[model samples]
Target: MKLIKLDAIDSTNDFLKGLSVTQELENFTVVSAENQTKGRGQMGAVWNTEASKNLIMSVFVKDFVLNPNGIYQLNIATALAIIQVLKTFNIKDLSIKWPNDIMSANFKLGGILIENTFKSGGRISSVIGIGLNVNQTNFDNLPKASSMAVVADTVFDKEKILVLIVERLKANLALINTNSQGLWNEYLSILFKKGVPMPFKVKEKSFMGIITSVSAAGKLVVSLEDNSFVEFEVKEVQMLY
Candidate 1:
């Protein structure tokens, strides 16, 4: 569980990738930076953040034989780990969006990105990156973004927050190893749009459905307006805005 803290980096995930190639860092090694110059999200979207105002960290783990279906469990565990840490601040209304975003009400609070390295045979390592908006007070340019300060109605100490997050993450990882189904159940309990009708778009067709469940493979299942159920991969459906 070696932790490396930096003042700035291009991207924590990228830093960890480079580090893994050069040296054999221990499993659970963490690389964190105060700011990321070229942060990235799923599908190469830029992860926007104000310098020194959020948490930008990546966790490196090795030698886990992660089944493709269990990938969703990993993401759920990571999001729950961060939520557990934020709970210490008594932050309420925290919830997880399917596949990987954390939110409160309608505002974005954080997100997780899990990248895997595979040899010809199987998976070799996983790099889990997290970005959480913490002390920033202004989001004038980013309407969907909100910070811990804004939601919690107070300021927070970044170092203490990081420490708690690491501890919680360790706990979540242990649970994942021991009882993944249990962890997945807990994740489903907090899933956003679980049982309510919501507008959804698939293949550019707008329709209404109630989110029924998320499969172990991270596919979302929806009960359509006609009471028929369908499963779609993450890219197949979008929550209509």
Candidate 2:
């Protein structure tokens, strides 16, 4: 549970990744910063947060999942942990949008970016970066963005939320270390728009599809209007909603 606090950084993920390479890092070593200049979201999307108003952090964990195929479990565990912690604040309509965006009542609350390093002999180390809007309410340019303060109408202590998230993450991650079957089911249960027809874009083309299960490899599975199923990588598809 070693935690590093920084006033600012280019990217917490990059910092933790470099730290792991240079020296020994404890399991679940966490690095948090008040601001990030080059923060990144899924698929290189820019992650921006007001200084000291959000959670900008990255966690380093090694050998969490035994096999490369099971690595998606890390994403599931991390997302579920955040969802559970936010629920305590009574945030409404909470759901996990596929690939890593956290949603609340159709608005974006946070996101996740996971980077995995595969070592020799089938070992894997992952750097998980999470960005959550805590007390920040200014989203003038970003239409879909909202924060805990705006949504709940109550300012929250960011440290309170961070502590609970870390605590829940450890517990949730430990479950997958044994068997992840139930974890996948729980992830889908609250998955945003699961089984509902929704619009998506692939290669600049748009179509309607029902969100189905997620592949073991972490690809989004969709059932198209033709009743045919297809798997899409993170870069290949875009959710219109």
Which regions in candidate 2 have their CA more than 4 angstroms from the true location?
A: none
Off by over 4 Å in 1: 120-123
* lDDT (Cα, tens digit) per residue for candidate 1, span 190-220: 8887898889987879999998898767888
The TM-score between candidate 2 and the true structure equals 0.97
Clashes of 1: 0
Q: lDDT at 233 for candidate 1?
A: 80
Q: Which window of ten consecutive residues has the lowest lDDT sum in model 2?
A: 173-182
- TM-score, structure 1 vs. true: 0.94
lDDT of each: 0.84, 0.91
- Clash statistics: count for each candidate: 0, 0
Which pairs clash in model 2? Answer: none
Q: What is the C-alpha RMSD of each candidate to the true structure, in Å?
A: 1.6, 1.0
lDDT of 2 by residue, 20-78 (tens): 99998989899999999999988888988999899998999887798888989999999
